[model samples]
Target chain A: MLGDCRDWHDVSVIEVQELTKTFGTVRAVDGVSFTARPGEVTGFLGPNGAGKTTTLRMMLGLVAPTSGRALINGRRYVDLERPVVEVGAALEATGFNPGRSARDHLRVACTAAGLPTRRADEALETTGLKEAADRRVLGFSLGMRQRLALAEAILGEPRVLILDEPANGLDPAGIRWLRDFLRHLADIGCTVLVSSHVLAEVEQVADHVVIVARGRVLRDAPLAELVRGGELKVGTRQPEQLRRALEEAGATVRFEDDRLWVSGVDAEQVGRAALDAGAVLTELVEERSGLEHVFLELTRAEMGEAG
Target chain B: MIRLIQAELLKIRSTRMWLGMLGLSVGFALMGLVFYIALAGVEMDGREALPPVTDPDTVRAFYANASGGVLFMMILGIVGITGEYRHGTITQAFLVTPRRGRVLAAKLVSYFLFGLAFGLVTVLATVAVALPALAIRGGSTSLLDNDVPMILGGTVLAMGLYALVGLGLGALIRNQIAAILVAIGWVQLVEAIVTVALPQVGQWLPAGAVRAITRTTGGFGGMGELDTLPPWGGTLVLVGYGLVFAVIAMVTAVRRDIG
Candidate 1:
C-alpha cells in the first residue's frame, strides 16, 4: 500500500476539518469534522437531509466546501495525481450509463486512473458481476447497478473507498456480500467510509461511527463506545415526578411524553424508586442501545433542541 | 490524455446511439443520391428551366444542393454529447476521471474525431451516388477536384464545431431533451428565419455563419448580395462558441453537487 496501514495507531487516511457547505441561506454541511483511519470501516450516519451526501461530495472534490478542508492521504482529492487509484467513490447507484456494458464501465474508470485494462475484468469478477459484465446497464436491477458501481470503485484497488448508501436496494444476500466485501477491503488495509441513513446495516459493517444531525456532527466514536450503555425506559402516570425523583437520586433522567428514560440506572433501581415513591409503575424495561436507537435518540434530541 | 481519449472512444463505441447515428448518416447520404437523380432527370427533360449546369463549378453546385441532407449528420454529432448528460452517465464519467478539465478535453477530441470520420463517409457516399447522375445529364464533375476537397473540409469542420456546441449545451443544461431542443431550434428554425429576415445580424450568428460557409449561392436566398465571412472565419466563430460553452460547463460541473 502507498499509505501506512500497519501503523494504524498513527495513520489517519482521511481527515475532514470543520467542513461547511451552504445552499442559499440553509447550511447543508455545517462545521462537521471527523477522521477515518486505515483498516477500518467508518460509518457516516445521518438522516436524509443531514448533509451526509454534501460532506461526501466535498470530501471527493465534487463540491467545493464553503469553509475548511477534507484531506485524503494527507492531501486534497484534487491535488492527488491519481484520484481513482487513491480514493475510489460511488456516490449514487444510478451514476452509470444504461447503454454501457458493465465491463466497459469499469474499463473507462481504469483508463481514467491509468490502470491496466485487466483490472476491469478482475473487478467485475470480484463484484460478482462477471456473468452480467457484457449486458447493458439499462436492463440491470438496482442491486446489480449497485454492484457495478462498487466494481467501478474497486477497479484500481484504491486505498480508500467512499460509498454513499451502498446497501440501498440490495437483497439480503447482496447486503451480506457487501458487508463481507467491505470487510475484506478493510482487511487488506483499505479505509472504507460508508454513508447511510440505515443504522443497523452500517453498524454491522462499520468499526467506527460518526453521527451527524442538522448539518453538524453530534457524536463520533468507535462502535463499542457508541453502543456501550443499556437504556432503561420507565413509564408512569406521573413521568415528571418520576424524572425529578430519579434526578434527586443521582440518576440521569430524560422525560419523553409520559415515559421517563433513565440512563446510568438499572431496572432494579427504577423499580426500587417506584416502590419507595409508592407510585404504580406500568412499564419498566431495560433495552439494549442498538445503533438505530442511538441514532433516533441523538437526532431526536437535536431536533427538539432546534425546535 | 491519450488514455482518457481512448476511454471516451470506447464508451462511444459501446453505445447504441453511435450505431444509430451511423445508420442515420448513411440514410442521409442515400437521400442526397435520390435528390441528385431527381434533379438530373428534370434537368435532362428541360435544361433551360433551372439554373445553368455547364461548368465544373456548376457541377460542384449540383452536388452541394443534393447533399443538403448531410446537415442532419451535424445534428447527430450534437446529440452525441448531449445524450450522455440526458442519460445521467456524466456522473459516472466524472467519478472515473475527477479532473474536470481533462475529461472535457477528452470529450472534445473524441467528438471531433467521430464527426470528422462520419462527415467524410457521408460526403464520399453522396459524391459516389451524385457523380453518376451528373454524368448522365452531360455534366462533368470529379469527386477528387480541388473544390470538392474544400467543401468536404468545411463540412467536416462544421460538424466538429456543432458536436462541441452540443457538448457544451449538454454540460450547461444536463438534460438531453432541453439541449437537443436548443441545438435544433437555434441551428434549424431560428437561424433559418433570422438569416432570411435579418441578413446582416444573422451572418454573425453561429448557425448562420456555419450555413453561409458550407453552402454556396441560393442557400439563404433572402440574404440578397450575401456578404459573409470566410469559411475559416465561420469555423473560428463556431470554435469560439464551443470554447465559451465548454468553459461554462466545466465550471458548473466542478462546482455543483452530483445530485
Candidate 2:
C-alpha cells in the first residue's frame, strides 16, 4: 500500500531492546523488545494496564527504564542534538495547558524544535484546526484536543512519529481520517509507531503489529502474515461422515452444530474429501482470522497462564 | 538554548495569569507606598511616633517596602515550573527538547527575567508615588542620593533572585498548589515569625536575606529592628540559596521519572 516512497534511510528505525520499567512494587513494563522500520506503521497493541503507555514513555525518555534501552537511530532520545527534528511523540491528548491558545501551543513546540513559527500555522491547517487556532484549549472537546495533539506531533515533520492512542476520542469519521493520515505518513516513508488498546483500529492502519500482554510481547509480525492462515468452516448434512473423511485426509476436524471446523488443509482439499465421502455440502467458506481473534486468543492464553 | 528560552518566555507570555499577576503586583506596590506615606509622622496610642518621609531611613524604608510585589514574582517563578506538571505539558516540553536539564535551565533564565520585569514595574510605580508624596510632604527629592540607588538596585536583585528560588522550589515540589502554599506560608508567616523570634537564626533565612538586600530594619507591629547582614552579604546568601536549591533540583529531576 505504500507508494511515493522517499528513499528513506535507516536513521528512522526505532529499536527497543529488552526495555523494562518498575514503579515501587509494581512492574509496569517488563522486558519489551521490538523494532519499527521506516515506511511502515507499527501498531503496539495491548489491553489497558498492559504497560503500553509506560513503554512508550520510556521510549521517549520521559521515563527511565530499569535495565534496557529504546534507541532512535542508534542514539538515546536525550542525546539527540535536535530531538523534535528527528522524532515526534504525542504521548496523550491531555498534554496541553488549557489556558494557552492552540496556535501558541504549537508555536512553543516549534520554537523548542528550532523550526520557524509559521510551521505552527501550517500544522493547524493540516490538522483542520485553523479556525480554532486562536481559541484556548479549555473550550476544545476531547476530539479537538486529540487533533491538536496530532498537529503538534507533526509540526516538525519528523521522520519518526510515536503516538499513543491517537484514535481514542475521535468519532468514526475522525478515526477513518486518522487511519488515512497514518497510511499517508507511512507512504511518505515516516516510521509511525502507534499504540492502541482497540485492535480493529490498528488492524485497519498498521502494516506490522506488535501484540503485548501483561508487559510482555506476545506476537510480533506483519499483519498479512499473522492473518494469512485460517480455518475453513464446512457445512453438511452428514457432519460425522465429513469429519471422518476430513480426518482421514489429514485435516483436523471438529464437529459442531452440524458443521465441521477443518484446519491443516485448504478449501480445495476439504471439498475433494467431501465429494469422496458423498457428503452433501451446504456451505464451505474459508474463515480467514482477523487480528482481533488472534489478539484475543493470545492475550487470553497469557492471562490464563498468569492466573 | 536561546530557542528553548524563547519557548519558555512564550509559554509564560501566552497565559493570562502573568497579566493578572502583573496588575496585582503594581497595585500592591502602589497601595503599600500610599499607606506608608499617609501614616508617616503620625503617632498612635501605645505606639512609637511615625518617622517623617524626609528621614533618610524612612525614605529608604519606602523603597524597601515597595518590593512587596516580590511575593508575586516568586509565584510566577513557581508556576513556571509546576504548571508544566499540573497541565501535563512537561511531556511535550521534554519531547521537544529531550534534555530535561536544558528545559529547566531555560525556565530559570526566563523566570529570572520575568521577575526582573515585575521588579522594574513595581520600582517605577514606587518612584511615581514616593516622589510626589515626598515633595508634597516637605521632603527632599534627593531619592537618588547616597544608598537610595543601592537600595533600589538591591530591591530589583531581590525580586530576580527570589524568582530563581521559587523556580527551584517548584522543581523540587512538582505539586502546584502545594508548592504555592508552602511558598506563601513560609514567606508570610513562618519566616516572619522566625525572623521576629530569633533574629540571629532568621537573618540567615531567604526572607532575611531579602531584607538585607533592601536594608530593611524594624519588625512588624512595633517590634524593634533585628540585626541584618550587609546588603552585599544578603545578596550573597540569597544567591547561595538559589544556587543550592537549583543544583539539588537539577540532580533530582535528572533522575526522577516523569509520570
Candidate 3:
C-alpha cells in the first residue's frame, strides 16, 4: 500500500468541473471548479458559508450537483470501485456518536471500507488518539473529537484526503501537530485538500491555495504566488514626495496610514527612490502581503461586489 | 455490501443503547407472558374469554404475543438509521459507501437481523416464564410439543420483517424523534383504533400481518377483532410493506443532500 502511494497522481486527482449546487432558492455553490492534485496540499480557503463544505461534499458524492459534476480519478465518487481505499475524507469534526469509543468509531469506518479492524488502532495511533481510543466520545473535548475524525479519515490509508475545517476545535499545539501531519501525508504523495476559514492555519502547510467566498472561487494559485508579489512600504516625513518618486520609478504608490504603499517594485528601488526624493525615511520594509492580506482583499472585494 | 452490513452491525454493537433496549424488550416479553398466564380462562369486556393454556391456539397466541417485545426491535431499527442522521454519521456512512443504495440496503439487512435477535430473545424469555407458570397452573407442558416451534419461528420472522419496516420508516423520516413517534403512534394508537373500527382494513396492516404469522386472530395491540390472512399471505404482505419502504428510503437517501 505504501509503495502504491508514489504513483497516485496518475489516477487520484480530484477534479471538480463546473460544479454547482443549489438549495431551493439559494445557490450555495455557484459553478465552482478546481482540481486538487496528488502529492500536494491544496488549501481550500473560504469564509464560513462559502460553499467550501458543499463543494467537498459534492466531490465525495454526499450531495448531488444540481447542474454539474465532480469527478475523482476521472470517475464520479459514486462510481469508484473502492471509494474509501482511494479517497478518505473528514467532512466535519462532529459526525461521531457520543456514546461510541474513539476506537470503535474508526473500526466502524474500517469495517465499512472493507479494511481490517486493526487499521482502526493504526489510525488512532497516527492521530495521537491511541491513549484515548477506549474512551467514549461523550466525554471527549472538542479537540479529541477532531482527532478522532482524523483517525477515521485515515483508516483506509487512502491516497487522497479531503478535510473540511479539520482544525475547528484544536488548541495551538494540536493545530501545529495537524500542520505537520498534513505535510507528512502530502510528502508521502497523498493528495490533501483541507479547507479552513482561518488563513494562518493553512498558510504554513499548503503548497497551493483555492480561495472561495460567497459560493465562488475568488482565486486559485500557488501559495507562494498568492502570498508574495513584491509590495513594499516606505514611511517618510514627506509622504507625497516619496509617493511621487516611487511612481516615477514605475511602482504603484498609495498614501495610507501615514505611509507610502508601493507596489510593482523592490525594496532596493524604494530606498533609492526615497533617497533621490530627498525625503527623510522613518521606516522602509518589504510589505509581505501574506495570505491574510490577499484573503481579506479578495473576500472584502467580493462582499463589496455583492453589496 | 456485506462489509457495509457488518459495519452497520458493528455500529449497533458498539453502542450501549442496543443492549439497554434488548434488556427492555425481554422485560416486556416477561411482563406480557405473566399477564397472559394470569388472565387465562378469565373473561374480559368486548371480547372472548381468555382460553386455557391447554388449547393449541391459546398456546400459539401466548408464544406469538411474547414477540410483543419485538416493538423494541422496531424501535432499535428506527434508532439505528435515524441515529446516523442525528449524529451526522450519515456523512461518514455515505463517504465510506458512495453508492448510497448499498448503505441503505446494508442498514436494512443489519436491522433485520437485529429485529430477529430481539424477537428470538423475547420469545425465549417468554417461554422461560410461560413453561414454569403453565406447569404450576396444571396446564399441559405438551403444548410445546405441538405447533409451538413453528409459531416461535414465525414470530421471529415477523420481528425481523418489522425491523425492515422500521428501518424504512426511519430512512424515510430522518428525524429521530419524529420517526420514533410515528412508529409508536402508528403501532399503538392508530392500528388499535383501526383494528377496532374496521377489522377488514386492520387485517391488511403491518401489525395484522404480524398477528397472522403468529396465528393470533384478535387485532393488533391485542385489542378489537380482526380476521387475519393465512400465515403465507401474512408473510407476503409484510415483505411487500418492507420492500416498498426500503425502496422509498433508498431513493430518498440517494437523492437528498447531507446537510
Candidate 4:
C-alpha cells in the first residue's frame, strides 16, 4: 500500500511504528510512534529522559527495539545500501576523535562513505568551519564541535538529516545561524529532524513538532496548531487601568513586565479597550502561545520526576 | 571492507600508542644488544663458562631476553575498540556502517593487519640489534638461517593473534582503562602464575600457546613458561583465542546498545 510515490508531501523520511525499548523493568520508550515527513523541519520535543534519544537511536539502528520497528525511507536503517548518502545523522556533537583535526575527521567520514575527499572541504565550508578545519577537535568550543558534527552529517549530502540536540552549545548568534541553516535545508527538500528540550530553540525553526513525556507522545501536531491559543500582549503607561479595562471587556489580564497580558482577546480588542479606557498604549501585539507553554501544559501531570 | 579498514587505520594513525609500541620494541632490543655485547662473557651467578642464552633454540628466545615487547599488540588491540567507546565515536562509526557485524569484522581484520605491521617492525628492530651484537660477540647472524622465515612469520602471527584477543576483550569490556588493566593482568600476572602453578592446563591457555607460536624457529625457549604446543598447534591455539573473543563479542555487542 505504498503507492503515493509521486507525492513528495505524502512521503515520510522517518516513521517509527509502535517502537518500544525496555531496560529490565523500566520501559524507556513505550510503544512510541511518530512520523517526520519530507521538506519540513520536525522537532522531536521531550523533557530530559523522555525517551527522545532512545527513539532516535533505535531509528538509526544504534539501539535495538524491544518490539516494533523504526524505518527510514520505507526500510530499516541497517538495510540501507548507502546509509550516509541517504540518511545523515549526528546523534552526538562530540563524536569525532579529539586527536584528529576537524578536516581529518570529516575526511574519515568521506573516506568511509566512499564520497570524494572534496566533499569534506565542502562540508567544512557549509558548516562555516573552514577557518578552523586544520585545528584539532581538542581545542574546539562546544559550538565549534556542534558545527563539526553538522558538517559531518551533511558530508554525504543526505536526503534526510537526524540531529539530537543540535544546539546544546551555541551562542545566540550561532543559534541564529543554525536556525537559518536548517530552514534552508528544509527549503531545499531535505527532511530535517532535530530533537531538543528547549521550546524557544525549536519554535523558531520547527515547522512540525512531536512532543513526548514519560515515554509517551503527548501531541503530534503542527507547530502553528499547538501554539494557536495565545495572548494579546499590551504595553501601556497605565497598567492598572488597562488590566481593569481589559478585564471589564470579558478578558483575563495578567500584569507582566509593565504590560497587561490579555488572554481570551485579540490585539485589536486590546487596542480598542485601551482607547476606550483612555490609557496610553505604547505596544500592542498578539503573542502566540509558545511551544514551551503548550509543552509544559501537556506534560505537567506526567513530569512527576519519574525519570 | 577495504574502506572500513582504511577508516579504522585512520582512527589510530596519529595516536601515541603506535609510536610508543615502536619505541618499546626497538628500545628493548637495543638494551638487549648492549647487555649481550658488554657482558656476553662476564661471569654471572658464578658460572664462568655459560653465557646468558647459549645456543638458544629460536630468535624469539633471544628476543625473549632482548625484546618480546611485541606482546603489547594485544593491549593495542584492546585500546583500538575501547578507545572508540571511551571517546564516544563508536556511535559515528556504527552510523556510517550500520551493519555492526560488518563493523566488527572490519575491525578485527583491520586491526589484525595493524597488529601484523607492528609485529614485523618489532622483529626488524630485534634483527637490527642482533646483527651488531652477533658481530661483537663473534657469532653468526640468524637472518640467513633456514628456520628464520617461519619463526619470524610465526612471531608476526602471534602478534596479530594477540590483537584479536584484545579486540574481543575490548568488546566484552567497553571501558578502556578497565579493559587495559584486564589485558595487562591477564598477560603478565594471570598467565605467569597459571603457567607456574599448573603447567598442564596453562599450556593449553593462550600465553602458553603464544610460546609455541613465537618459538617455532626450531625449538622452544622464548616466553616458554610451560611446555607448548607444536608451532602449527600453537598457531591454531593462538588463533582460537582470537576467534573465541570474536565469537563472544559477536554475541554480546549487538545485545547491548552502543552510545
Candidate 5:
C-alpha cells in the first residue's frame, strides 16, 4: 500500500468539499465545507453536538461521508501512500489498547506506517511521556493517554496533523505546551488542523478559525477578524424597544431570546439607550466579540432557523 | 505486508498474553504426559496395561492428545483481531493503516504463524515429556516409526486453520467477548447437541473436520469412533470454513463504521 501515491507537491491543504454524513433520518453533518491550509494551524471549532468529531472522523476516512469529500494534499485520506507519514490523524482518545504500553502503542503506529520503531521513542520524548513510556496505558491518566495519542500521531513525522480535541484532558501547563507545540509544527510548515468546542482554547493557537454550527460552517476567516467583532449583549424586558433603540443608535442589533445583540458598538452606548427608554434590565454584559460570541450567536441562529 | 505483520507481532510482544499462552501449551502437554503415565497401570481390579503392549496405539494416543493444546491457538487468533475492537485499538489501527483489509490480512498472517508455533511447542513438549515415560515403560520411543511425524504435522496444519477460523470469526463478530463465547459455546454446546441429534451432519462440521485432520476423536483421551472424511477432504472442508470466515469478515469490515 506504499510507493505508488503521487507526491503531494506543496499541497497540504485539507479540503472538506460539501461533506455530508447522514445517519438514518438525521444528518449528523450537513454539507460542512472548510479548508485548512499549509503552514498554518486551523481550528475546527463548534459547539457540542455540532458534528466536530464526525467531521474529523470523515477527514480520516473512519466514517464515510454520505456525500462529498475530505481531501488532503489533493487525495482522499485512503489514497495516500504511507498516509501516516504524510497525514497524521489522532481523532479519538479511545483509539489505543489499554493493555499496551505507551511505547508499544506508538510503536504499532510506527510499524504500521513503515517508519522505524525508534520514531516511537522520539515521539514519546517529544510528548513529555518518556517517563511513562514503558507503562501500560491502562494505568495512565486521561492527560497521559492524550499525550500518548499525540506521540503516536507524530510517530511517522507526518507533514499534516489532524487532532480532535487534543487538549480535552490536559492540565493548564499541558494545554499551554500543546498550543506551543502546534504552533511550532505550523512554523515548520506542517499543516495543522485542531478541533475543539472551547473557543478560548483554539483562540490562542489557531491562525485561521472555521467556526461551525449545526453541521454548517458559520465563520471561516482569519482569527483576527472574529476578535474585533465584539457583541454588546443587552438583556431587557422590552427587547423590541431595546432592539429599535440600539439600531437607532447606529448599532447592528440582532433580537434573540428577548435579548438585544448589539454589534459594531460598545456596551456603554447600548446601556445608555436602555437607561433612557426606561426598560427594566435583567442583565447587561459586554462580551468580547471573539470566537465565543460568534460560536454562541451562530449556534443560537441555527436553533432559531431550525425552529 | 511484512511490515504490517511485524507490527501485529509487536502488539503481542509487549503484553503478557504470548508468554501466558506459550506456558499454557507446555502445561497442557505436561498434563497429557502425566495423565497417560498415571493411567497406564489403572484397572477396576488392578488389571495389567493390556491391549497388546507394543501395538503403537498407546503412544499414538499419548502424542495425539497434545493436539488438544491447539484450542488455545484458536483463541489466540480470535483475541488477536477481536482484542483490537474489544479494547478500542482498532480505531488506532485503522488510523495508522487506513486500509482495514491490510490490517485484517496482517492479522491472519501473524496469527497463523503464532498458532503454528503453539502447535509445535505443544507437540514437542508432549514428546519431550512422554519419551522418558516411554523409556521407563520398556517401549521404544521412535517418533518416525509410529506415524508420529504425520500426526504432529497434521496437528500443526490444523492449528493454522483453526487460527484462520478464529480470525475470521473475530472479524465477523466485532465484539470480542461475544465472539469468544460464541466460538466456544458453539463447539461445546451447540455442536455437541447437534452431533448427538444428527451424527452425519455433525461429523461434517468444522470441529469434526478438525478431528478428522488430526486423526483424534474429540475428547481428552483422543480415543473414540466417529464417521469422518478422508484426511485431505477434512482439510479442504476446514480450509473452506476459514475462507468463508475471511470473506464475511472482510465484507463486514468494509461496510461497518469503525467504532
Candidate 6:
C-alpha cells in the first residue's frame, strides 16, 4: 500500500517501516508497513497466524523486530520517557494476576505510570467495573476481564491505545459498549489501534482498516475505499441467457455454479437489460460489498498468488 | 523506577498467596521453636542424642538447621513471579512499563523486601517461642548476644537470593511447574550433589554460597562438607548470581513475542 510514502495530513500516532520479525527460519512478521493516526480507530485485521500480535508486540517494544522500526508519537516506544503516559495497550486480557483485586491491579498500573492512585477507581468506574473493583479477578467472567483490561489501558489517559482482540470474550451488550467507548475515545482525539479476528466488529468500530495475511499486508485503506474497490453483485434468474445478454450489452459476465455473476453494469441496468430481453426477473438483488467479503477476497487472492 | 516498584508492591500485597505465605512462615517458625525445645530437653537430660549437641553454638546450629523451613519462602517467591506468566498478567505489566529491565528490577526489589521482612518476622517469632524452654535447660540466649545481626542478615540474604532465583526461573521457564521443579531441583538435588562432589567448585553455587554466608551450617549435616567462604565473598557471589539470572530473564522476556 506504500503507506510510508503517502503523507497522511493528520497526526500519526503509530508508524511502522518495513516491520519484519523472523523467529529462527520462520518469518512471523514479514515486510509489513502501515500507519495509524489520531482521531480514528484503526482496525488491524488478520486471521490466525497472520502476525498481527507479533506486529503489535513489536510496536509496543515487547518484542524486538529483526528489521524496521515502530515509532509511537514520532519516537520509538522504548525511547519514550513516560511510556505508559504515551501509550496504553491491552495486548491480551489474560495479562493480569487472577488472585489480585481488579482495583489493586489497576492501581499497580497507575503507580507504574506515576499517576494518582485514585485513577484506578476512576478507571473501574469508566469500564463499569466499580461494583467488582474490590473482588478478586479470579471470579471475573471473560467480559469482565476484558473490561478490566480496558480500564487498565485507559488509566493513564494515554494519547494512544493498542489493543489485541479486545472484544474476544464480550457479550453483545459488552461489544456495543466497547464500540461506543472506543469511538468516544477517538472522538476525544485519542489514537486507537485495535486488532481483531472478527471482521464485523472491526467494520463496526474502525474508520481505517489494515488487512494482513501470511505475514504480509494485503490492504491498508479507509473502510469506504476498501469496500468500494470490489465489484458489486447483482443476481437474476436468466443464467445463460443473461450471460450472453450482459456480454452483448458491454458488461463483464462470469458463471459460478448455476448463476450468472455480472459486473461492469449497475444493478438497475442489469434489471433493465433483462426486462428488455423479455426475461422474467425472478430475483434482482443488489449486493454491496462488505468488509468480510473484501477481506476474504484479498486474503484468498494473496494466497492464490503466493501458491 | 520507583513507580514500578510501588506498583509491584501493591500487587504483592493484594495477593491471597502472599497472605498464605505469611501464615506459612509463622507456622514454620513456630515449628522451628518446637524442634529447638525438644533439642533443649535432650540436652538437659545429658542423653547422647543424634549427633550429640550440648553447647550454645550447637544450639544455635540446631535452630539454624530449622531455617530450612524457609522453603515456604521460596514457594512464595516462585508464586510472586511465575504467577504473572501463568495467568498472562505479565503482558499488562510490560505494556505499562515497556522497559523490561526496569520491570524486572522492580520485581526483584519487591520480592527481596518481602522475603527479608518475612525472614525477620519468622526468626523473631521462633526465638520468642523457644526462649522459655531454652532457659529452663540453660540454653536460652539473645540474638544480640550471639551474633544475631550476622545470623539474621545471613537468613535474610539467603531468603532474598532464593526469591530472586525464583523470579529468574519464572521468567526463564514461564511455566509454574517447570519453574518450581527447577527451583527445588536446583536447591535440593543439583546444588547438593555438586557441593558434595566438588567442594571447591560448590562454593560458587548459589545455595552453597548462601550457607557459607549464613555461617550456621549443621542443617545439611554431612552434606555441609565444603569449607565455607568468607561471609562477604559469599554475599557477593549470591548477589552476582541473582543479577545474572535476573538480567537474562528480563532480556529474554522483552525480546520474546507474547502469545
**Which runs in model 1 stand beyond 4 Å of their true positions?**
A2-6, A232-286, B40-49, B52-58, B65-80, B144-146, B218-225, B239-256
Instruction: Please report, as a residue range, the 10-residue window in candidate 5 chain A with the lowest summed lDDT.
Output: A1-10
* Fnat for the candidates in order: 0.68, 0.92, 0.86, 0.72, 0.78, 0.88
Per residue, candidate 6 scores C-alpha lDDT tens digits across B10-89 of 88888877778777877866775566556543534565333323365545554454356556667776787678778887
Between candidates 3 and 5, the DockQ winner = 3
Clashes of each: 0, 0, 0, 0, 1, 3
DockQ of structure 1 = 0.53
Query: Global CA lDDT of candidate 1, please?
Result: 0.76
Please give the distance, in angstroms, between residue B89's alpha carbon in candidate 5 and its true position after superposition.
2.1
User: lDDT of each prediction vs. the true structure?
Assistant: 0.76, 0.85, 0.83, 0.80, 0.80, 0.77
lDDT of 2 by residue, A1-307 (tens): 1234555544448999999988888778889999998889999999999999999999999898998999997788998887887887888888899999999999999988889999999999998899999999999998999999999888888889999999999999999999999999888888999999998899888999999999999999999878766678899988888888999999988877767888888889988998999998999988755578789899999999999
Judged by lDDT, which candidate is best? 2
Q: Interface Cα RMSD for candidate 3?
A: 0.8
- Name the lDDT value of residue A71 in candidate 5: 92
Q: Assess the local accuracy of residue A63 in candidate 5 as a C-alpha lDDT between 0 and 100.
A: 89
Native-to-model Cα distance after best TM-score fit, residue A238 in candidate 3, in Å: 5.4
CAPRI-style class, candidate 2: high
- Give the per-residue lDDT of model 1 (tens digit) for A157-210: 788999999999999999999999999988887899999998878888899999
Write model 5 residue lDDT over B136-187, tens digit each, in one string: 8766588886667767887787777778888878888877888889888887
Worst 10 residues of 1 chain A by lDDT: A1-10
Each candidate's interface RMSD, rounded to one decimal? 1.9, 0.8, 0.8, 1.3, 1.3, 1.5
lDDT over C-alpha atoms for residue B101 of model 4: 82
TM-scores of the candidates in the order shown:
0.86, 0.94, 0.92, 0.90, 0.87, 0.87
Model 3 docking category = high
Checking candidate 3 for backbone clashes, the offending pairs are none
Q: Which tens-of-lDDT digit does each residue in B189-237 have in candidate 1?
A: 8877887688777777776556555645435222235556676776677
- DockQ of the two-chain complex in candidate 3: 0.81
DockQ of 2: 0.84
